[model samples]
Target: MSLPDELYNAKFAEYIDSMKIMYLVDDRFKMICDDYCISKVNAEKFRQKIERDFQHQLKHENLSKELEEEILIYIMKNI
Candidate 1:
């Protein structure tokens, strides 16, 4: 039988942090572009790509639903 290593969680936490930051940046960038009247090619496709990435991160990172909700709330509040 093998036991989980406590220290291993630190790396996973960092990965989650990175994913959260990327999601935040992507969301903010899209809003900023909209405000600036910047037209992107195939913008819906790009949005879908980012959405898929964020969903994958949430699922694979194993972050709690509450935490994910809070992160999104924070982003919405600030931007």
Candidate 2:
């Protein structure tokens, strides 16, 4: 199933944030984020952009259970 653009963007953003945190402390995490389309500079930019765009309470909900499961498996395999 395809996700709405907004949902996909939000999920990608959340994943980026998690990766940034990990990247700051772990080299492996940095590698994973880079592999997944987020560079160190890009991750920082994403954080700033998210904060600015979502001034109010921003929540990310993964409605696609199958997609989520698939992503988890993919991440696990890659990591």
Candidate 3:
């Protein structure tokens, strides 16, 4: 199944915004994009990989749901 460009772009923007906020909070917080040294193309598989990796790290860190959601919302609003 293929995803439309609009959906991909929106999700990519959201992911980038979220990552920027995460970076601001923790300079050590690394993303797959950084690790792979690859450009973001907004592909569905790439999006899923990013989301999965982020969620895994968040879970491992035991970060609070409220804090995560707040950061995400703040990023969405401000960026």
Q: How high is each candidate's TM-score? A: 0.28, 0.28, 0.27
| Model 1 error, position 42 (Å) | 1.1
> What is the C-alpha lDDT profile of model 3 across 1-79, one tens digit per residue?
2222332354467576566566556546544435333343436578899999999998967767777888999999998
Residue 53's lDDT within candidate 3 is 100
Candidate 3 ranges with C-alpha deviation above 4 Å: 1-42, 63-79
Count of steric clashes across candidates, in order = 0, 0, 0
lDDT of 2 by residue, 1-79 (tens): 2222332355577675554456677777555645555454568788998897675433333446667998999999999
lDDT per model vs. reference: 0.58, 0.59, 0.60
Of candidates 3 and 1, the better by lDDT: 3
Clashes of 2: 0
| Winner by TM-score between candidate 3 and candidate 1 | 1
Worst 10 residues of 3 by lDDT: 1-10
Candidate 3 global TM-score: 0.27
- Tens digits of lDDT, candidate 1, 1-79: 1112321245556665454455456767435534433334356568989999999998867767778998999999999
- Model 1 residue 78 CA deviation (Å) reads 45
Clashes in model 2: which pairs?
A: none
RMSD of each: 24.5, 23.3, 22.1
TM-score: model 2 vs. ground truth: 0.28
